[model samples]
Target: MQVAIDGPAGAGKSTIAKKLAAVYGMTYLDTGAMYRCIAHCVLNQGGNFENTDDIIRIAEKAAITFDGDRVFCNNKEVTEEIRTPLVSRHTSDVACIREVRELLVRQQKAYAKDHAVVMDGRDIGSVVLPDADFKFFLDADVLERARRRKKELDERGIVKSLEKIAQEINQRDDNDRNREEGPLIQMADAIVIDTTGKSIEQVCDAMRKYIDGAKA
Candidate 1:
């Protein structure tokens, strides 16, 4: 069974989905990582990010792979490189490109075709896997999300003011929701989980209940 997890930035979709995948012995696909990988490549190659044609060309030729949590670009490990503040900002911009989303969506679909996978992204449930066996929309208040994102960056020794982090989070939400190719939205059938004030294990347990019920 394929599980689609969709959420806005800092909603814990990736964390929860990774745990769910491990619990159920499913393949975990970090769709965001794919976009970030492309973004990393674009910046490294010094391409004009505003040039859609150039961006798409780089995306199409990108050789991206994942070894557990480590992301490889052209056989070079860039797991840490893609998570930098610069690439983080660039990823938000690159993620909205129509051609980029199309290419990744095709790859994401192919991954789910023959695997029991747990995939998470902004548009997974609503666009990438509309018929997924299980779907979830995880969310939290803007402030709470900003806090989580700050903590994540802090762990990487990247410090930024909460106000600035909040601003970036809000901007990303707007772009993900307003983008033309695959706007982010909560699907009707998806189980909505408010992740505010909840621990990772708590969220995973709540999701587990639903996965268990559905399988029964």
Candidate 2:
């Protein structure tokens, strides 16, 4: 089984994907983290974002893997490192590179070919797993999404103004939707779920009903 969940940042795609993966006994692949891994690598190497060649070089050499919830890039654990606001802001830079997207998408596809996987990202449903057994597009109000991100950062003692976070999310939305390669788009066949005021359990249950009904 392959499940593709696509959405903008902080729409709870990773959280819901993980939950659904565990419930269905599937491997959860955080495709966003893979891009973040490349961004993180470039940041570490002091590579310029505008230098597409340098970014592609970093991406080609990036060996990203997931062990449960931990993310490893180039054999180094970056689970927490990639979640930083810095990496989050720069992920779209590397993700927009066509060569980088092609490289990572191949890896994502190979993983799904070998395992029953639940993958989430901006373009998973529309690009990476076009033939996925199940596809979902999760969305929420921009303000709500910002609040969700602020809460996560707060838990880690990383304080940031809600307004600022909202601004950044808006910027990210623009970048993701406008990017030339593997842009964030809702596939026509995807089940759209507006999680604006819903609990994770509620959202999960709603998606589960779709999958369960199909199975039955």
Candidate 3:
């Protein structure tokens, strides 16, 4: 009973996935955090990110563990640390590497082997869990997505210019779409849900109904 939620950043995939997992009494896996953990390590060690080989080695040696909503890197709790702007910029770069993607995708699959898991990421449906019992691709307009992200950052007391944030997101979208390995894409069988004006609960309820029908 795996539910794979694939979507771009700030589309509420994380919030929806967590609620969905709780509804199903399943663990929630955030695949992006795995790359963030690796990127954090590489940056912390003063390694050159441009050197893909070094990043790969760092990724292979790093140990990232997800326990509930918490994330541990090398046995140290780093759930919040990896979400910093520095790590955010580097994570997609790390995720683009074939070796790292293979490693993390394997880890993600292993986490869902027991089933009854809710996993969310850009490529979960198209790449990681194509056969998941329920698959959904969440999306929203670019401006709406940026607004959501701005609100989250505002809550954290980290103020970023909207112009800069929009630029970054657009660039990321391009890279995510063009990446050779596990690019962000909508699977043909995925149920596309536009979340432009919907609240988190509204989106969750819709998915719940879909899941219930599938189960029925």
Candidate 4:
């Protein structure tokens, strides 16, 4: 079955999606990683995020592929490159560009044509996979999201204070919601799951229960 999980930053969508996908034998696609690749490539080319036309051109020429958890851009392993603070901050800008979103959204939809995938991103359910067999919107409070994001950065050797991370997370939330292209809004049919105060297993169990209940 095709599953689309959409949510704000640091909501644990990727982790939950991967585990659930493994349990059901579905392909796990991280659309955020695709945007990160775009951001990384454009920055490498010295392209500015404010240059919409240039960013669109760069995105059109970008080729991204994933091997398990690793990501590649134009045949170069960029898994670590894209997670840098520079790329992380600009990834949302790339995602918000209409033409950039058009290109990646097309690619994301094509993947679903040949495989059952569990795709997670800001607009997966609302735009990329509206007819997904299962749709979920996972979210948590800003503080919790900030804490999770800080931990992710710390593990990668990128040090940033909680207050700074929280500010960036909040700014991203505004950008995602206000963007004209594929704004991050929950779909009417999506199952909203509040992930605050929940462990990974607890969240996964809740998702699996939703599937079982729906199928029954």
Per-residue lDDT tens digits for candidate 4, residues 44-99, read: 99998889999989998998999988898999998888888788889888988888
Which 10-residue window of candidate 2 scores lowest in summed lDDT? Answer: 58-67
Clashes of 4: 0
**Total backbone clashes of candidate 1, pairs 3 or more residues apart or in separate chains:** 0
* lDDT per residue as tens, model 3, 106-206: 99998789767899988999889988988999999888888888887888888898887777788888888889999999889899999999999999999
TM-score of model 1 (CA atoms): 0.98
Better of 1 and 2 by TM-score: 2
TM-score, candidate 4, is 0.98
Q: After superposition, how far is residue 130 of candidate 2 from its true place, in Å?
A: 0.6
For model 1, residues 22-77, the per-residue Cα lDDT tens digits are 99999999999999999999999988888999999999999899888889988999
Please name the candidate that would achieve the greatest TM-score relative to the true structure: 2
**Against the true structure, what is every candidate's RMSD?**
0.8, 0.6, 0.9, 0.9
lDDT of each: 0.92, 0.94, 0.89, 0.92
- Model 4 error, position 153 (Å): 1.3
Best-to-worst order by TM-score is 2, 1, 4, 3
Scored against the true structure, residue 208 in model 2 reaches a CA lDDT of 100
How well does each candidate superpose onto the true structure, as a TM-score? 0.98, 0.99, 0.97, 0.98
